[model samples]
Target chain A: MKNLRLKAARASLDLSQQALADAVGVSRQTINAIEKGDYNPTIRLCVSICKVLGRSLDELFWEDD
Target chain B: MDWLVRISGVVALVCIGVMVYLIVKMSPDGFRKEQYDERQTLERLKAARAGFYAMLIVALIYLIVTSFAPELGNQSRVWMCVMLFFGIGTFCLYAIFSDAFFSLRQKPWLYLLLIGVNLLTQGFNLVNYFADGGTLRDSVGTNYILVLGMILLLLIIGAALVIKMILDRTERD
Candidate 1:
């Protein structure tokens, strides 16, 4: 769910999923669906999301009980 | 007087039941039209939310009124008239709020049918009033508010449909 929100904030910054995907090299839908919570990204995606969001992996993804 | 309120309550209950049944049977997500734009989808979500809240408000109002005036309507004649008012109010509230809040990609066909059934119900009550020796309490007259309300109600439905059709056609390219 946290990753799902990253793309929305990026979009609000006027960054298209395609552009962000290109910067991070993932599918546009990977960005779109993740932003909508329809899909979950990989560890690589988690790193990219943190990089793009200007945060760390620990801040973005936490283990659930 | 209590009977009148009870009957209206029953009819309202029936309509709510039918609406719930259709809602279950017809998935709200199954809109077949191609999504050409994001606005159409957002509109539908808004309208549906409005309809839901309006219904809840109507139910709460009825519960409070009946709790207070349980004896105000016991006769069939009185209940019929009261329900006529209640039905029209609920129908209009659903249609207008939905229209104002959401631009449906496609207007739910059930809404159009509800409008027709509601109008017909009022018309039937009008005839019933005349046939029953015509008591003022028994008459459900069509007033300017109801006419105006129904017009705005249908107008919004029509507008939503037309916009959807146009958007769908444009998206075909």
Candidate 2:
């Protein structure tokens, strides 16, 4: 369940994991965990990441059936 | 000689007190780092759980061994202390490498400082042991176990740091 959508969004912005983590006030490892599907972030963090990437939650975290 | 031991003992006690104070006051979120996010906190809890179970198993084994071998029972306290030290060390090292203690972006100098202190104390213990005409058999007490445990902990931390550095470098490249 890797978040390829989020990764692509981050890449489009030229943001490294550490950069995004800094923007979100988290460690790069936390970002890595999210991308790797190793951890599910809270909705609050989801909103934060969406805001940083200029993406809506649907764009970054939502999955289609 | 007695005075030297007493002074060093007091210094060690003071150092432990300072450590407790820092841990209690500074580490409201554990390890006092901003990088300790939810994921890292979860990892820390997992590591703690694992360490606890491992320590329990080791203690049980020690109990069984000592009970079976009464001669070895005399050294039970030393062995138990060493096991506890290593158990806690494993938990800490796990947390550190997992980025639960400090963010990878932040330098973990406190851990390095702790390793250095452990080495220094080990040196002092070795010198004192020799100064007291202590034989190899006499080196099986609390002092010896403490030094050995610290050395093992130091090695684990050093290895973890090296691995982390290499990983970071590779990621950067």
Candidate 3:
């Protein structure tokens, strides 16, 4: 359940977890947790992250069957 | 001597309070209250619950022990110190491992320095106590045990934080 899509998107943009977390106003650990699938972020956070990474929710957060 | 002990205890308490206040004031959050993200907050809540349960269990054991030996009731302060420190240690260890103990703006090194100073102070107090031929049941018995417990708890939490940091460094995002 790791969010490799989110990780890839973050890497494509050259954003470290700390940078992404700063952009989203959260701790780096939170970003790490999200990428590791250890935490489920709220939709609001999802939107924020999507906006930051220039990605759609479906692209970064959606799980494939 | 008892009065001197009481004064020293008050002074130590005041110093600790001032140090905590200064730390909060110096925090980047500026005393508005340290901010934690949703996940950290959730983890902290769980840690708090764990600490509460730990304290409850400790208190139950203390009660049972005191009931069996009514004379131990006179050392209620020491038992209370144990219970409080045990709960605090539980909370600290849980939060440290969960990465929820420090706010985003907090400096762990600052806390580590503070703990070191407190530990040194407590160690000195303990040395002085023993030097004065003090027993665990003396007039300042509670103070002695309280200082000892605080030192032990600080050492544990400090060690946990150090270990967590080392582990975190090896973890890739």
Candidate 4:
């Protein structure tokens, strides 16, 4: 359930999880949790993360087979 | 003995002062936003719920104990305080260790310093008690156990904060 696409997007921007978390005003653990699928963030947090990574919501949060 | 009670009283006051200060500091909008987010807030609410249940259980047990042991008549108030302390302390510890309180942005040093001061004051009382050949139970009967429990609670929270600080630092690095 981990968001590998989000990880890739962050890497492409050369941003660490801490950097992204700071940009979104959250703890790094929150970013890590989102990436690991350990926590389900609110839509607001999802939008914030998407905005920070310059990604669309579907690209970062939506699951595709 | 009177001196010991006075010292313990002062230590208790210092601890109360520190908790009040932290509560006040954590109340402001800026501090809350900076140090506490949705996740932390959710965790705190959970902790509070757990604490409430614990308080009920402890109170029940205390009533049972006192009812069964009539010889402990006059010390019921002291035991009640102990029960209340543990009930609240359990929740505080849970919140702290779960990253709900004293997180990366919170100023844990001030709390730690206040706890350290309380510990030192208690240590002084202990040394004086030993000099007079007083036993631990005697000290508690004199109400020193209240301060001791406070010190133990603070130490647990302090240790949790230290571990959280290290973990957060490692994560950032």
Q: What is the C-alpha lDDT of each candidate?
A: 0.54, 0.79, 0.90, 0.76
Please report the candidate that would top TM-score against the real structure: 3
Fraction of true A-B contacts recovered by candidate 4: 0.14
Residue B139 lDDT (model 3): 55
Model 3 misses residue B74 by how many Å? 3.3
Report model 4's interface C-alpha RMSD after superposition on the true interface residues.
Answer: 2.5
lDDT (Cα) of model 2:
0.79
**Per-model RMSD to reference:** 13.3, 5.5, 4.9, 6.9
Q: Candidate 1: misplaced stretches above 4 Å?
A: A1-65, B1-36, B72-173
Per-residue CA lDDT of model 1 for B40-133, tens digit only, reads 2343456556555655665666567767987643333444334444554444444343233223233445656775676677656656766886
Q: How do the residues B1-173 of candidate 4 rate in per-residue lDDT, one tens digit apiece?
A: 99999999999999999998888888755245446666777878898888888878877876777789866645665666666777778788778767676555756778778878887897688667768876545325356666666667677766877887787776562
Question: Which tens-of-lDDT digit does each residue in A6-55 have in candidate 4?
Answer: 88999899999879878987777777777878778889999998888888
Candidate 2 local Cα displacement, residue A33, angstroms: 1.6
Tell me how far the alpha carbon of residue B145 in candidate 3 is from the true structure, in angstroms, after superposition.
1.7
TM-score of each: 0.28, 0.76, 0.84, 0.71
Candidate 4: Cα lDDT at B5: 100
Interface RMSD of 1: 12.7
Could you tell me the fnat of model 3?
Answer: 0.64
Q: Over the stretch B1-173, how does candidate 2's per-residue lDDT look in tens digits?
A: 99999999999999999999887887656555454677887888988987897788888888898889978777666777767876787787778677686754557667677777877878688778868976433335556666666677777777787788677676540
Top candidate, metric lDDT: 3
Chain B only: TM-score of model 1: 0.33
